[model samples]
Target: MSDFIEQLSPLHTVEREEITKAFREVFALSAGKRVLFWMLEQAAIYQDAFAGEATNSTNYTLGRQSAGRRLIEMLDAVDPRFYPALLIAIADLKTIDLAAAESLAKQQEGEEYDVEA
Candidate 1:
């Protein structure tokens, strides 16, 4: 009994419960949402590692291509329906402009409300 308990005690029960809870949260999300968030996180990592002052260099291009290939491989493991949404989300993330987004938000705040229209 002691040996059996020791063999299974690598992760304490509390740690296992925490891991189970994290998995449940991930499982609760729609497949598309999961893929979108995963791709966005991957993109940020790639940008930080490869899209710096040498972004236009050949090495950067190669690194970006490799990261894109890995992203596609990851997407292939999930439902096909999520592919388009994930692609669009990643593209939008890549092209997003913070300044333009802030300006647009400010412009909308000054607009009159037109719920009936």
Candidate 2:
């Protein structure tokens, strides 16, 4: 991962350390929970953008593009171990059905809990 880190724009030592620390924290989260959080965050952006009748198509499109960029940034920052879960979450996002995505996440969370028990 050093190669991956080196490819990023240069950062001050403290800034680099902080980023590494943050990544460690994110990496510590259960994979399923991380995927669920990502789904909910994307859903929130869609809900906010489309909440009002006054919202224009342009605004909605911009919101979606912004959310997609953020998702890409998150995928880059996360550990490789989370890739499978992330891919699954991305697939659910493509369905454009927030309720179904949420249900899937909940089901995964339950399965994770059962495995732990």
Candidate 3:
């Protein structure tokens, strides 16, 4: 649990139910939707982390390359607890592709399974 999560406890009963509904809907989404959900969350997280940083053309390219590598590392890890990851995944009957009521599965090809400045 986090202080941030605890802060959400102030929500009214209806609000809490709505939040749970969000999870339920997300759980019902398909693979592509699940991918987009996590991707958008990552975009928001990165934007918050570096919204004011200065950068040059050369460094921007290098930074993009680094981000790609790290993204692959994360996807391969198959664990949301990895440092830079979606806080929770939407679960379905088969498996929770990305935090829902189902189990978390491995990569599509196999059951095989980080961050920096």
Best by TM-score: 2
Using lDDT as the measure, name the better of candidate 1 and candidate 3. 1
- Model 2, 1-117: lDDT tens digits are 788767766566568678657765655565644554566466454344554566686586566758766655664565554555655656755665778788999999999889853
Candidate no. 2 TM-score = 0.37
**TM-score of every model?**
0.33, 0.37, 0.27
Cα misplacement distance, residue 74 of candidate 2 (Å): 3.8
Worst 10 residues of 3 by lDDT: 97-106
Clashes of each: 0, 0, 2
What global local distance difference test value does model 2 have?
A: 0.62
Misplaced by over 4 Å in model 2 are 1-11, 43-58, 77-83, 88-117
> What would the per-residue lDDT of candidate 3 be over residues 1-117, giving only the tens digit for each residue?
356556665556467567456544543456544564566445443343343455564466556556655654544343444333332433342264233322333233244421233
Q: Write candidate 1's Cα lDDT for 4-115 as tens digits.
A: 5466765685675575465445434665445546755555534545545775765756765577666555554433444565556556654565667887887787664533
Q: Of 2 and 3, which scores higher on lDDT? A: 2
Q: What C-alpha RMSD separates each model from the true structure? A: 10.1, 10.8, 16.0
C-alpha lDDT values of all predictions: 0.57, 0.62, 0.46
